[model samples]
Target: MRLVHVVTLVSEDGAYGGPTSVATGQLEECATRGHEVTLLSLWRGGSRAPAHIGSVPLRTRPARALLPGRFTGIMHPLLVGDMWRSMGRADVVHIHAGRDLVSLTALAVATLRRKRFFTQTHGMVEPRHRLVARLFDRLYVPLLRRARGCLVLTERERRAVSEVIGPQGPPLLTLPNGVRPEHDAEVERGPRAPEVLFMARLHPRKRPDAFVETAALVHRKLPGVRFTLHGADEGELPTVRRLIAAHRLWGVVSYGGALSYAEALRAQARAAVYVLPSVDEPFPMTVIEALSAGTPVVCTDTCGMADELARRGAAVVTDGSPRAMADAVCEVLTDENRRAGLVRAGRRAVAESFSIHAVADRLEEIYRNL
Candidate 1:
């Protein structure tokens, strides 16, 4: 099977967030099973792209991809020609997000060409989006309903999307994200200077402000505790920096902008607790990475992965507030026995539920059906 992934961004760009990461994982699974795979993304501003994801071929083009109503990762208009050409070559065009202009272009092309296509619901059609965007989604829902199948990362996302489409929903397939354990050797997680780490993009939706506020609250009680925020400086970095400076959190918190996976793992290995304060995360891959690294997680109750983490005894889920998050982090940082238990359970959870090989076998079954 020759599969083409239509997404806003590819991993080559520094903004390799959840969607790109998930796509890369899926592509790897497909390719390793001997399926010909290619990723087509609208190239925005990035110095370069990664070499390849497992065995999949990756191609990105610069184009004007955004229109008036969408917040697409790739909004390059110059790439329409390339998108059409790529679609022509693919056996199945897997569309990742629908709000983007390039995605709309792909939707139209897939219809015109009578091609088989699938769309992965990365929680785009959620209630959290803007009113105007939600209204636009009313118009966009039918196009998605026409797809051959829809891949959902979590049951929460599936339910949210199903509410809108109801019985008319496309063929739904639930596939969770997989993790390839970063640490080969058993590296014990020790209490370092920075006891907690936030290893995700510094964006508004990620609720980096909450992280800043929580860190301040945590510092008030635990004066010696340290927090490190890592990931790329997107548009929200300035605001986060401003908040940190205004609140005088300079000494307590260190801003480590966008480290590579290896660098992120090094940071994760040192920290005792991993904190993700994202406001609307469907499922956080970082939580799994943290668990796989034997680091306990302190995340929001609203997180989809929090349920899984709870079952694994690898995380403490708090209310979606700075104070609550602060308390959770403090608890995770101080409780040695709980931390040790979570670390052991977290590693086991990763091995059983999120291992790459386990996830690959599941995805291969879906590919065969598709």
Candidate 2:
């Protein structure tokens, strides 16, 4: 099968976040299965072409900034042409992120070429502002309706998207993101350090400030514990810095900045606990990486993976509050038996359910049927 993935941005550097990681994982898995996979994405920083995501080909074009602030959309005219040609040669086109121009262009090209395409909303359809919600309902919702199938991370997201697209829209498939199984072996060796990791963009939505506050609280209980904040600074870096200084946790809490994909996996493996304080996280790839590395996790209950992990006894799901997160981290660090149990369960869950091979098998089935 020839598969093409259309996403906003992707780089060999660690500039991108979850969506790119998920796309790359799926593409690599599909390629390993003898499928010809191509990733069509906007190259960040500058124009780069003919890059390889392992064996899979990466074709990218320069991105034109559309808005002033961060998290703004990139306008890539070449994307439409690229998708038109790629879709003509491909068996299936998988579009990621619903509320983006790239996705809208892919849908248009797929329809024009009479090709089968699946659009996966990385949980971006929900709008917090009334004006944005109105725009999505008027414009994006119709484009989503044209997709052959829609993919969502959770049942909650499926329901929310269904409400907007109506009952007559494309079939929605629930597929959580998966991580590479090889990470389990590539993990850092020896005894894990007394470190808690918070790896995601420094955005308010991710609540890096809350992670800092939680770090302060945990430090009070476990003085030896260290907190590391990884990932690129999006918007909350200043706030995190302020909180770190205000709490006088200069050495106890340090920002490691952004790390490459491989580096992040090793970081996860080295840490005692991985923390995600985000709210309404559809599905975090970091959580999957943590579990795959046999590391326990402490995340907010609002996360999409929280319920499943909690049920499996693989993670400590806390309310999205600093104190609650602090307590969860403290418990996981202090109790040896509890930590061991979580590690075992987390590894089992990743192997049995969240491995990329299993996810690719399901995706291939869907693509074939489509």
Candidate 3:
């Protein structure tokens, strides 16, 4: 099968976060299955796009912000041609779409060419009363109705997308983000380092500041405990730095810059606990990656995966507050038994429910049906 996957942006250090990671994982899995996979995307950072991922081919066009709002007005001039060629030749096109120009253009070309395509928005496309969101919806929602199906992460997301695309929209399917945990088996698991880790983009929604605050609070209780944050900046690093400085936690809370996907897993492997203070996150890939890495996970109760993770005892769900998060971190740090329980349950939950092989199997079925 010839499969084409499209995503909005590819940065030097994966600043765009989960959508890019998820798409790459899916396409690589497809490539290993003997499918001719092509990944088309807009490249940021002044460097060249990589040649390929495993056996899959990659095509990228440089992105430039020619107008207002860095991402909203960014344009990838030559990407439409790439989209036309790859999506036109594809047996199925899977677009990791958003309301941005790149994704909207991909949808337009795919629809205009009458290609068999599916869209997975990664909680990006949702109903909003904002003027920009309203405008973007008017442009893309009709195109979405022509899709074979739309994939969502949670029931909340499904409902939001439904409102955006309306009653006549395509079937909405809930698909879990898949992960590969084979490398986790190799981790030395006697006692992890006394480190609390947060890995995600440092955006306002991600709450990197909260991580710093949590670090401050945890330090008061457990002075030996260290906190590390690794993520690309999305206008929130300044706030995080300020909070760290204000709290006088310069060395205790180190800010490691953005990291590659492999590097993130390695960081998780060494950490005593992984914490994400972000709220309303729709199945945060980082939390699941932490789980797969055998790091006891701590995330907010409002994330899409919170209920299942809490029910399975796979993670400690918090209330998106530094105090709650710090308490959770402290508990995981002080109690060896509880920490071990979380690690065991987290790895089990990921293998049984969020394995990449199972996700690929479902994707294959969907492509065949299309």
| Candidate rank order under lDDT | 3, 2, 1
Best of the candidates, lDDT = 3
Q: For candidate 2, give the lDDT of residue 107.
A: 71
- At residue 292, candidate 3 shows an lDDT of 89
TM-score, candidate 1, is: 0.85
lDDT tens per residue, model 3, 311-360: 99999998889999999999999898998899899989989988888889
lDDT by residue (257-319, candidate 1, tens digit) is 787655676788888688898876887878887888877888888898778878777688888
RMSD of each: 3.3, 2.0, 1.8
Give the 10-residue window scoring lowest on summed lDDT in candidate 1. Answer: 65-74
The CA lDDT of each predicted structure is 0.75, 0.85, 0.86
State TM-scores per candidate: 0.85, 0.94, 0.95
lDDT of 2 at 312: 96
- Model 3 local distance difference test score: 0.86
- Residue pairs with clashing backbones, model 3: none
Give the winner by lDDT: 1 or 3.
3
